[model samples]
Target chain A: MGTFLIVDDDESLHKVLVRVLKLEGHKVVGSVYNGSEAVEFIRNSKTKPDIILMDHRMPVMDGTTATREILALDSTQRILFISADETAESEALKAGAVGFLLKPIRSADLFRAVKSCLGEK
Target chain B: MDPMQIAWHLMEGTNDIITSINKDGTFSYVNRALMEKLHYSESEIDTLSIGTIFFPGEQKKIKAIVTKDTHEIISDVQTIMVTKEGEMLHVEGAFSPFFEGGKKVSTIALFRDISKQKKMEEDLERERNQTEFLIDIMTHDLANIHQEIISMLDFLILNEDLPNETVGIIKEGISEIERATRLISSVRKISIVSKALPDLQCMDISLALLRGAIQARLAFPEKTLKLVTDVEHGEYFVVADEYLVDIFYSLLHNSLKHSKKKDVTI
Candidate 1:
């Protein structure tokens, strides 16, 4: 089991991801509306999560910035950026994100991606 | 010139039908042209009040005219009027006031039959509405079908192991779905282009192409693919919709599907 943080502006999509991940036996650490908030939550929290599912387009600060900051804080941080933005995958890669998932994401794809990020088979 | 003779000459020369009415609603005079158009006799016109000639519930309109400040009222107003043979003529008219030295004298109404024009306008409106409805259905319904086909292909790729022949058939189905989706996209593009120029944003084209290639690769793992970025760093930017990058992704997928050898370049 892995602890994951979901960062997305869409509440419906966040709920869906949480439900899917929980069903797959992953513990959801928390969820926030944007990248900046995700950064703040990670800073204050005593426990670091196994994975972060971040969205690209956010109101204040984007997934790329958050990923860069998180990795700066700890280079070994595992982060996956999820976005409807078609340009997300490479951007996430450049920012040192582990992987990228597209929006309207399938449950199976999400499972595979989360497992991949967590270094699980 | 006498008042009646002047009125007669005015009506005879103009295309419009003219009639004069007293404040009491009695017809003081109707020109010969008007009499011929209505097929009414001089004696009959003289016996009827101007209000009696109007179709039912037209007294309110006549009252409006009497109370109006303008000396001339030219309106595309619709109302029915009674002919000598008791036929109802759908008419649109201009009603004007006649005055003698600042004292109210009469009301002169000029009218034309407009039933044919009204019918044509209604038919044109209906056709316009139907065309819009059809376009809406085509955009939404076809898009849904395209999405469903893509989803089914994804499901098949993930869960099922099939023979080479079955895989070939699935690839063919994907091609068909791609064709249909392309057609819908072209229609949507035409509409957007016809309206106003789209506001383009500067984007990294090479990165977009790479992401699209990666997505295509993930979608079709069986196909061997090679992507080379010929674009220079930061120089790869172009002005276009960020979402429009999907077009390149679709094109790459199509190219990969048809490549003879295992290796394909985008």
Candidate 2:
């Protein structure tokens, strides 16, 4: 199990993801609405999450930009992008995301990706 | 004035560039409009050949029109012309051979400038491309919203305490969301097809039919389907894209869904 931070514009998604991640025995460190808040959380929070679930399109800022900023803040932080836009995959990966998951992702796939980030089977 | 002079006067008054090419390829006559558009005077035109008036890039096509062995009328031939200052002008025209005593003596051609229309078409194409890019962005956002709804619904369905009826309702809503996603995908495909020609290749249509039937079977597991086709005996090859399978799938799926009986034949 690993600690996680959720960054997405959708509040309902945060609720479900928090519950789901808790059910899998992972710690929900924090949740932020956009890339700017995510970067702020990473900077000010006492506990660093093992993985950050990043979303691409948001009002204040976008995931790829945040990914670069967060990695610059803490090179050890692992970011995984979940987005509906497949076109952003290359940019996200190039900006230092661990993985890119297309939206409408099944819970099974989501769990697998999180587990893989922890070097688990 | 004679009838010939009257015809000459009529040709001279028009904005269209008109010219006659002799058997030896030299210009025998050029209307006033032709001389003005080409920046050539009456005396200068006598020294010019038919080939010199056409843009260098259009020389090959012009050669075909002028060197034909038989007397034929060529209409709506769009070509580029070069003025004396070496500027290119786009024009469309018809060319007809003038036969004297059953022998082709010269060719009379008429051309009208269409550069402005071509530029407008190019601008419209650019606007269309921009619209497509915007549509793609919208589609991505819509898909994200759909994904959020689906994830929430899936979480709700996981609750063991919920009644079977409520679970069934939630499941139905999820299915509807899936249908909406498919509709978006179809619209995007249609937009793409409208913009460019589809890449076509020879494909075995029988395989596509079989795949479609398999898809339909998976889609409607409750319905018993009997697909009868003569595709097995021969190779049914056609030039088409991957959507051919979707076409067959839609037809069979619709037929199966609408049929009242449990068993369907198609």
Winning model by TM-score? 2
Total clashing residue pairs per candidate? 0, 0
Query: Cα lDDT of model 2 overall?
Result: 0.84
User: What residue runs in model 2 are displaced by over 4 Å at the alpha carbon?
Assistant: A5-16, A27-81, A85-102, A116-121, B1-112, B119-123, B126-134, B197-241, B262-266
The number of the candidate with the highest DockQ is 2
Name the runs in model 1 displaced over 4 angstroms.
Answer: A1-121, B1-10, B13-15, B32-39, B47-50, B55-58, B69-90, B133-150, B160-266
Report how far residue B202 has shifted in candidate 1, in Å. 16
Worst 10 residues of 2 chain B by lDDT: B214-223
I-RMSD for candidate 1: 6.9
Compared with the true structure, model 1 gives a TM-score of 0.44
lDDT of 2 by residue, A5-113 (tens): 9999888788878877877899889999999999999999999999999999887999999999999999999999998766589999999999999776767789989
